[model samples]
Target: MRRVVLRGFSTEGGPRPDRTALLSLGLVVLFAPLAALSLLPLLWPLRLAGVPLSLGYTVWACSAGLYGLRPVQLALARLLWPVRRPTAAERERLDLVWSRVLRRAAVSERRFRIWVVDLADVNAHCVGRDLICVTTGALAELGDRELAGVLAHELGHHLRMHTAAAAFLVWVLLPLQALALLGSGLALPFARLGRHLRRTERGFGARRWALIAAGRLEAGLRLAFAAPGVVAFAVKNAAGREAEYQVDAYAVDLGFGAELLSALRWFEACAAPAAVAPLVPGPRRARHAAAREARPTHPPLERRMAAIIARLDAAPAAVPPQGRGRGRSESSRTLLP
Candidate 1:
């Protein structure tokens, strides 16, 4: 029955689904706190036994709950994360571009707002509501029309409510990172014991290993206290990737998927080689590095470009009206897939 409901929810298009948003919020409300509570168990033994509760675990739990709040905060921040201390002129420029994009898109307040940051990274993102973020590097590298293509893609995310879902997952992921660090050496043993205990508790062997792992990890003393958090995080991130694809479909629907793909290829071809691991020394640092390598705010350019190409080919075209003069010529040029 639950699977059926989720399957129905996955059939997305048209205006946004209120039930889906509520369902997601419900899950965050129901599970995030429980996941946070489970973190306490990982440290139970530390208080009773000699081992201390790694600071990472505490931070992880807090982050899980905090994740529920980020979309709202991010909406409030409004293109603030990658930027710091914008000069008056810089702010004005961002405003001009943002206003132009919003006006062109005909986006309503219910849809999203465009925000530009000063970061050098070539990335753009949108969280819940109409809050969209584009970096300085992204704006500088791409032409105005090409950048509009990027903005269109981000608007696709807003149309899909990807931000709301992402907000709920952030905190849950933090604890998982802590778990990966804490259970590095003992992960296997704790997983084995956790599985057996779960099977025994249910009176029959049920295949809910993931939940069991989370429960064990939260239980604090289960030896693999961080196991559930790590496992759950991976699952969530995988889901996050799927959401990106859905947004890609929306981008195509908005008449810019192909252009977005070309832009992505251009970005990837020019980007500096990003390191796979962090050089920082700390418990959570390794997990941070791993996550960065996994998804540096957005998926790798190659994969994203390929996905966009695939989506564009799979769907019918919906080209927007070309601008006047030389810019129109550039837009008309066929970009090789």
Candidate 2:
């Protein structure tokens, strides 16, 4: 058996303090004191029984909610993000590239399962502990090497336990999200009533203005209630973008730097039309421009490519040339078998 060592590639990219995680942690810390104070009255009786039940019950409830609902969450994930087994042709094409990547990483084939999703977006991701999902568009758009690079990047996420962390974070924020949803639900009737009033021809000028004002008030209230969750989402996505960079570096360390760069360039090219189409002087262009501003979960392709290039430049000798002899060479071993 031939051993392929990743020279100069340390998996220990030390202590990336995710700002989103920190923000979430900070929110929890802040909430703890407030919760303890708010629940003090209710928990007074329990405290009389020699239990610090205010904080204790809060902690227990949260822990139970997160852990107990985990299995249900996993099941829901599968249902929501359904993927199919790859067709024979797809399997054959992907297996060659995937097997090579696995061999390079020295990971057991049994440890992970790959599924093809019917999505138009050119992307792939790691789900949970052992599931890697690739979109049909990704297979269509990326070359074999580029595809391998994507898979390697997702694998990096898996190896780093990012998926698990993300799951846990989602669990932590679930109640907040539910509260936001409930706020929206409660506000919906008021909004509908206001709209109905505004649309009524019978209404006088002042009445019409009053209905509009009511609508605005309801909207404001809804937004106020949902603001925390919205802020949390933005923070979480910011951290997620940082994770993308880390995973990109991991792929680079695995000797897929150039391939990943190429893949990013391909994404950039694909996005160019949507980006440029908005700039063309037309009414639809405004909508297109607005759509273009809608941020994706991952960092910008240019930023990701730059990060990968930086990694490549930092360890130029670590990227072994393809088709090189297995015998000792100055450069790192070829990652693609």
Give the per-residue lDDT of model 1 (tens digit) for 1-337. Answer: 1110011122234336343344455556655655666566566776678655666465654554553354655644543365333457645655654555455455653345555666666667665454566666665666555565667666655555666665665545554556556655455566666667766565334546554765666455433555566455445555555555555555555565655555554555556665663221122211110012336234544555555655555442343222212234355543333
Q: Which 10-residue window of candidate 2 scores lowest in summed lDDT?
A: 284-293
Report the C-alpha displacement of residue 150, candidate 1, in angstroms.
Answer: 1.5
For all candidates in order, the CA lDDT equals 0.51, 0.59
The candidate that achieves the highest lDDT relative to the unseen native structure:
2
lDDT score for candidate 2 against the true structure: 0.59
Report the C-alpha lDDT of model 2 over 222-315, residue by residue, as the tens digit. 8876676566666655656666666677787887777766566556555443443211122211101011122434555555555665667755
For each of the candidates, the C-alpha root-mean-square deviation to the true structure, in angstroms, is 11.5, 10.6
Count clashing pairs, candidate 2.
0
Which ranges in model 1 have alpha carbons more than 4 Å from their true place? 1-36, 39-106, 109-111, 173-223, 277-300, 314-337
C-alpha positional error of residue 289 in candidate 2 after TM-score superposition, expressed in Å? 23
